[model samples]
Target chain A: MSTTEPDNVALNGPVVGRYRVIPLIEKGATAGMRPAVASKDVQEALALPGTLVADWQDKAIKRLGQLVKQRRGLRVFLDNCTKCGACTDKCHYFLGTRDPKNMPVARQDLIRSVYRRYFTLAGRLFPWLVGARTLNKALLQDWYTYFHQCSQCRRCTVFCPKGIDTSEVTMAGREILASIGLGQQYSQEIITKVKSIGNNLGMKPRALADVLENLEEDILDDTGVPVRLPLDDSRADVLLVTPSADFFAEPHVDGLIGYAKVLHQAGVRWTFSSQASEAANFALFTGQHDHMRDIALRIRNAAVDLAVSRIVIGECGHAWRVAYSYLDALVGPLDFLDPAHSRVEHICEVTHQLLTQGRITLDPQRNAGKVITYHDSCNVARGASMGQRAGGQFRIPRELLAASVPRVVEMSADTTKQKTFCCGGGGGLLTDDMMAVRIKGALPRAQALQSVVDSDEVTHLVAICAICKTQLSSVLPHYGLQHVQVTSLHHLVGDALVL
Target chain B: MLGYLLTAAFVWAVAGSAYRLIVWARTPSTLPMPLTPAPTSRVGVVGRLLLELLTFRALARADRTTWLASLAFHYGLLLILIMHLRFVWSQLPPSLVPFIGLSGWATLMLIIGLSVLLIRRIVIDRLRYISSPSDYLHIILLLTLAASGTAMKRLWPVDLYGVSQFLQGALRFSWQPLPESLVLVVHLSLVLLLLFVFPISKLLHGIGIVFSPTLNQRDAVSAQTRVLSGSSHSKTRE
Candidate 1:
């Protein structure tokens, strides 16, 4: 294969450099990968009673009006984009797919333009002149095609001069689409599963108990320690509400193993509640506020029923964001939980404290074979904090990694911390149909990881979010760096824990 | 006739701005969407807003060229606004007299800043793609206002005493004939048009920044225990 000149690389195609900058393209409705439409069963599960309505367009317009009245962020964001282009180059999807519509400002304008035509005087008088368009069938199709492209990662909000959050706009657009009976099948299906089976994967209580039993057997055989992964034990001091993926997915299961080992060594009494086994709430992804509240209420009820004083969440990025930021607001007066400790604590925060306080010891040499780097999952990095400090989400995880690993190298500074890129599989776009979007969107992150691998001999890419772990694991091979293993931050901790 | 139009524009601008503020205020922010490493206290939020307002700190951190142009444009407008106080007040404050003389410099800065911003929107690939006709029109309008105001100041000087008398008369609800210079008339008309559009267009960003949830909300989630509404879940949990 002849290598093309770097300068000759097309703007709308991938570039090879220190970091690959994907060229801009017009990836409209048929971008080779579109999310499946939400089925009727999924609609009923989400309590969206109007899914079968014939007048969806009118209903959508009315729903948009109601949302604008309720949410100040939606109204203000619709008004505030000066289109300064600061956020144009900031989106990972824009960087990866090279689609201009993937740019945060343009993505927001998809809905903003419709809002203007209906709401603003200028748009009503001269729609074409102001780039405003009527909310037609074409516009709604664009909303589905483009809004799904956004990971709802708020990286663009950090650099925004007006602090206009595009995620809020994306959520509003998704909500409007859902109101009119159009919803992405992935998030909708997951919500239905969580509502009925108490987890996204729909693994029943017996399956969950069986997985825990197998995990216990493997841990005992390997580590010579009989660490119990207890379930529904009301007497426990802490309740662990983790993503269902931790019980099923590969690297994610290892992260769960780490949590079990840390809890075992710390001598803390923690149990998983079967009633609220899953922490990942896909309702947030679909912007169904009522469904989000209903899912969170299950956790609150479980905590009350179990009489657990403190609730600790596992390594799920958006789940932690919901737990830390929105849980209290949605279903709270969590006054029953211990106020001295955070009502909900990240598993990393707990493990980091244990390591620092000498309550749990780790031998970094156990992980000495691998040189590691951490990917700041966008939701946890920008949307939530870990400990009391402002950027504890970024710091606490790295601290745990450094304590557990022999050597650690950070990815490019621009691509880490508050300005981190998404792992291309968030915001409920992790279905098989959206594989093309997922792969292209992973380019920017893959390029950043590639840089560290080339220079620092980094062997493993660590992530805290299950989606990130799975996405990176699948996409890293396409970048010609398949040897680089995608592992979890807790997986390393578990390896080094001196049991 | 020109005096009445200017008065009407000013009234519309003020009333429209009040309505915008009321709309924003009436819409409740049910969730705390503060972008973190955000301030966790009320005082900290004030400090954050002050820094953002005075320096455009966030923009500066994101892109320096845009930050410099925006900072110069806003500060230049502030200086020109202060100089306009000479028209309303019978006796200019002694401290302000010295700065009023710098109107020449302020005018130059305003034009230069507007030109830089206009050039950026025109030449930058990303910016040019996003620019609507109105975005360009906004800058063009401001540029014309700056140019006409500057020409009247330096090239074809207007009767300042007569203009001030007309402004003072208008303030006191009395009609006075506007200055008979073409440059002065154009300048005043342009200013009126800007005010008319200020509350209606993206220009509402001036006030929108203060109410920005990300910039203004405190990040004190741990301190406040949210009281849920009396929904079925509340009773079910109990």
Candidate 2:
């Protein structure tokens, strides 16, 4: 017998290296499911010692156990469910989808079942006792698809007897998935761009300069105003951070146009920083808290560098949420800006007040529609809790909508003032990849709109957030809604300008 | 000697648990939901309380398995508390022991039910996900207390005189020697650990969850009713 054996084991066939096929760590495989590769880069980053590939496997297994344990903790609630449906009537998705899976309780059970099996001692020991199957490739894919369906609306939590935040569970799941290097590609890419370039759209200094130049051109063409859109405008009276979409997209860009026109008309000194122009922070959507911190840091730094007083966040939903909810705590207690004086006003608020004070005039005649409904973005209206200083309380937008549009019909289940419906776009579902779900998810609003659309004969849907404008505009057509252009609450004011 | 050590440990644990309970009780309950108009009542206070009890919906609604784990663990713990109250009653006037006994049996049954749930956590895969070392310890401590209490009552009755003396001494900070009963010692010791660890761990969630501000914020149904005051400060003076 030869003393030396061939290097090839032919275990499964050469997938891991030249001679060895790494057996799938997970038990079954579906078609197109790629084998887990232990990249040298990954190995270097993880700092794996020796050729112990099993080390990574073991750590993942341990983390899986921890994840499972957390999931199991969630199970106690499932088994005890009274199913009073308190949370049922509360979900916008369920109300929209009419799909039971969209129901908060029903949606929770999907992840809950998996948790029961892997973590609970009964599930682990009995295997068949509770319905937990080992998390393999198929299950992981399911987690990816369905988990993304949650928009983290926080509505269900209100009805929950115990304040169980499903959003937290969704976030934890996403983070766990990320740890395994199985992050949602688009979301991860957005986070990465935000990390490196200061914006999710990857508009760095040069790209932002180009965008400003283009925006100025459009501004000159449309309004004939030689507006100076400054970047990092030092010693400015105010620094405005508009959502990146305002520079590029329609109706939203019009919001920016309205902003410039309002600023110019009021003779208020303000500047836009090229570096921190984006108000829409996708990090909130991805549940990447650190990245959110980084983005907030950059915005704060830009404000400080520009020596501006107030930070006027242009119409964006979650951006306002981040600013109002976490900005102070994260950047905070600045000596230059009094906590009370750090005026973080929504554009609708600023313009609305200015209008009411006779600083800005609106036509209200231009928006002479039979019916106009204002859709409150979840983040803007409902993100903060009551009693907090930054709760904002949805006063400004409501006032603006009431004033700017005629026949302001309320959505059947509209959470406008306080309990506004999510645009189904928050948490970064505004992009096209999640388009189907986004369109389908818009059904709740559409169904609510149906009664008003028919009875009230609504023609225009007003929104303040850029993402809402993009998502609702793209989605409204699918629901047989036409001529109901999704315009910003600002657009209504701008177009109907009595100026 | 071991009995004295167990008793000392039990005292330490109870003191710790009481401290935690106070902290948890005082923490505020504010949820971060959008400012919707609050429902007049979720069918009123009595109806709401019933819903919380029957559904445990708040906890269950967070995620399912956690709800089950928590409910089982909680109901079980509740029963254990009732049984312990019986011990407190034995020292009370004779009339109270009968009242405590009636409640104790009901609680005993609850403990047995919860123990089944506790055991299930280990055996079930799903429960294990959220289960931590502390979780297992909690269940074990609870189970031990329940079992030991049951064993003392049935299999090995503790000397009433010794126990009474010990209780009196423990309460007064006097040195009346404790009676030696293994079950009593285990029961008492586990109770102590549960207390000391309460504030620092997820167990505090029991109190924290009830008052979580995120749940209490009125849902955003109506926008703010007030009109914009004015824009005197619109100019953002540098």
Top-TM-score candidate index:
1
Q: What is the per-residue lDDT of model 1 for residues A1-499, given as tens digits with 9 covering 90 to 100? A: 0111212112333326543343444544233345777887777767675353688778887898899999998898888877777787788778766677888888999988888888888788878877788888777777888888889989888888898898898888898887777877789888888888899888889889999999999999999999999999866778899999899788899999999999999888789988898999888887778889989998999989988777889999999889988988999779887655546888988888777778899899998789999999988987788767668888999888888999999998888998888998899988777776777777778788878888999999999998898888876776676888999888899999999
DockQ of each: 0.40, 0.12
TM-score for all models, in order of appearance:
0.94, 0.65
lDDT of 2 by residue, B55-76 (tens): 6765464446546655655665
Q: Which ten residues in a row have the lowest lDDT in candidate 2 chain B?
A: B220-229
Q: Compared to the true structure, candidate 2 yields what TM-score?
A: 0.65
The CAPRI class of candidate 2 is incorrect
Query: Which regions of candidate 1 deviate over 4 angstroms?
Result: A1-15, A18-32, A49-53, B222-238
lDDT of 2 by residue, A1-499 (tens): 0011212122222112210111211111111212122233432332232222334334444555554334332322333222323455456544443444455654565555555555444346544433445656555655555556678777676556655556655655565555665555556666656656777677878877787778788777866667667677664666788888888888787777777777767766778887686787776765555667778887888878877667778888778777766676557644454233344656666676677678877666667754688787776655642222234445566667667666677775435555556767666555555565666566556656655777788887888788888888877777677567788776776666654
lDDT of each: 0.82, 0.58
